[model samples]
Target: MARRRASNEELAGLVQGEQTDAVRRLEDRVAARVLGDLESRFAVLSQRSITAWVAAFGSVQAESGDTAALRRILSTIRGAVRRLLGPLGPRAQRELDQALTDAVLLGARQHAAFVEEATGRATRPVSGRPSRGLRRRAAAIGAAIADRRDRALAILRPSRARRWSDVQAGIGAAQSALPATRAHIATTVNEAVNEASLTAIDHQGAQKLWIAERDACVNCAAYSGMVVAADADFPAGLSWDPNQRGRGKALAAPPKHPHCRCRVTAWEEGWAPEGVPSFPDSLRREARRSIARGWSLPTESGAARIRAARELLRTGAGLPKSVEEFAALAVRAGRFTDRTVPTGP
Candidate 1:
């Protein structure tokens, strides 16, 4: 007996899963390079600052020091920050460019393999150059890092400083830059894949479908499994309403918002995979459930969450008991959008 061959769906799942893993690994690599460099630089700066201050003021923990000496030390640290960290943007851009090239190439390869498997023909190769959208995002993130460093330096500047505690507070404020950089790295990687998918779709003349993670935000959920032509834009406006009455501009691919994990895959008629009820239908159902359950609605905006919860209530759809309770409570008391709301298994 011969071994069984996997169906188109199985093959697609295998390849797509591999691509997802590749994207993650690329993201980790870029982040490690950029962030590890940042951490090391900060560590060196911190150590040198301590050593300098201790040498001049007798101790880094001193409550008060010679005023002119403290000013001079602070000035030196400012110069050091500019000298040591000023190149961060250019360095990060280099990392982003390289990682995006790899990500795009991998996407192109997987997509070509899938197309060949589905239709037994080879498609054109995708360019590995980062798309303009991706470049813009990278530049923005790099600029933000530099801006944060500058702001941190501003805070570290002596303005009638009385204690080392104040210096510590400034450093703490500066550390806020790290989290946003981490999120941006994820966003940039996802966008790179999205760009590649779009290019592959163009090369193969295949339709593309938006794929949202199961626990995706309401906005991303709205696009889950939505199929569109290669040249067409997914309809604009991201709203939680089942009808999706949003006013935002149309999008070309995944990353409906910052830090979005949504993706896209090629779609064609008669290639629907086996063992799933219906991919598009399932995604639509999940979106409905997300709205009804108030899952991932406006984590950053309390007012938006309350509005979304209220809209869900007004839709006349049957909300789960807990969702109804919390939606009502949230509407009654405009708060707690970030609170953990259960998403059913």
Candidate 2:
């Protein structure tokens, strides 16, 4: 009986370890491929349009000739957008084209209509050139935008929803395998250390962390990387391919705050990387380090932070008590406290 019980525990650990390794390996492959494509796309957009847009906006602020200024500003804005979202081909183009077109065309038409009503003759307000050419260009641009949006919208339902569903399903399938992965690790650990019995490492919480980091990867400018729940057991860096570009770190203990189910996911550029008002780097640094330190949550403030984290995670910010319960469990896990923060080059 003792032998059987030992076998069962050993089996569980083996299973957990295998699942962790396999999922981590597979996730690395998927993330690298997908994120690389997106990064290339974003880099292209950011590089081409930002300069001209900045110039135009800057010129306008400096009180350049109003008409020329308006022309440059409008042209810059239009060009920037095209540079950002220009399709790779039919493959990437879809419903988003229509949305873009609808918005751009609707805007251009509004401007043209206003211009015609006021000036009577169709002429460029600033250039004295016939407005026909400009309006035509605007119309074309608008249509292009709309076409892109349309394409995006059309495929969006299937591509995005389905992709997400598939990943989630993959996550579910992974749950059973975690024990296998952990078992291997447990055997290895058991040989050397007898600290604690291995339990389900925060698999659910890891998924949540993945989801959060995914969002930051998509939208956050300063995104450095993700710090996840202590219980969630994020894939360790040494365990993964060193070639993967992302930075990963382990927390010392569970989260101290409510719904703070995970630790901080830092972006390299910090928040508001699109040149909007941003948080102070020092403040951000301090906040991340402080959170990583694993102090107990200060009742109300901790609760609010947890709620905010949930909101950030898009988990619908469930009841405060629920978030708190999860957070407290994390605290008990003793995994949240210490972590290394990587500064990206």
Candidate 3:
């Protein structure tokens, strides 16, 4: 048998250098400068654009199994935006789309990891505590409703609606997933960031950011993205001063409803990479200051993380090994497919 040639250290280093450059190229993603929301969060859009393209590719290029075909498929999707963006537009779009797609896929891999972890820890060694405060509200609401029901019965009246939409309003505090919560916060933060950055942020982009935040808040339980900050609102002109990784943005309770677990996070205009265009300090300090908020929980009984873990594992086995796999599993088990997980009535 012929002996295989070994790669020397210098060649290995050069190869590693090239690999790193290629990877960094792939990882670079920029959200559109558009002001409006895209259909979902920036991250989810990032994931979905890639997912949809990849799925389309998988469907179209089943037997050939060509890796180049995947890139080409992504190229095809990028071509449509080229009119508005030019040649480099495709690359940026590809990066954003691929990020979202990869995130979902990695999330599945984490699902499998979560399953591996689940058989051990009795409870996740997580960040925030599940609030006893939520139960207090639920009890308070339930009791008040019950008293009304009792009073009406004594008067020979029909029991008023037990399923009042407002009754479970306080349940948002019950949700405890970290990654998912982070996604929610991340989506919102991205929006606020864009608003803070772009002169004229695209409306479609803004919508996509919201969808991403909602989905993250309600779906996966990995990272608790919701670190409620001191501000409730944000203005445009976004910039960051590095250190966004462990940085915590101010969060506030959403204005929409009482049970609303929706949260908004705000960052200092210079919190990210230096030289990125920033919003006005008025946008920064005084006008529309975002606030901090409470929590996220299912209205109905939340499936234990263990159950969520089990569901993740069962579906994540082989199929595409991505969000679709999880989605398929959820569908088979009769679970709802929430694109924007931070769902509202």
On TM-score, the leading prediction is 1
**How are the candidates ranked when ordered by TM-score, highest leading?**
1, 2, 3
**For candidate 3, lDDT tens digit of each residue in 23-88?**
223222222322122223333423543455446445323332444544453343333222222322
lDDT of 3: 0.27
Superposed model 3: Cα runs more than 4 Å off: 1-126, 154-252, 259-261, 266-268, 274-345
**What is candidate 3's TM-score against the reference?**
0.20
Tens-digit lDDT track of model 2 for 1-345: 011112222222222233234333433442243223544544454354345434644531243334554454334434433443344222122222222233233223322322233223352211121133223422343344345434433332322323323322322322222222223222221211101111111211221112111111111112223334434544433211123224445423212111222112211222223443232233233232223232333322333333333333343222345444554444455343322323232
**Rank order (by lDDT, best first):** 1, 2, 3
**Please, what is the TM-score per model?**
0.70, 0.25, 0.20
Q: What is each predicted model's overall lDDT from 0 to 1? A: 0.68, 0.29, 0.27
Give the top-scoring candidate (lDDT): 1
Q: What's the distance in Å from true for residue 231, model 1? A: 1.8
Expressed as tens digits, the lDDT of each residue in 84-169 for candidate 1 is: 55676677777877777787787777666655555555555666577786878777877887887778788777774446666655
The stretch of ten residues in a row with the least summed lDDT in candidate 3 is 285-294
Model 1 shows how many backbone clashes? 0
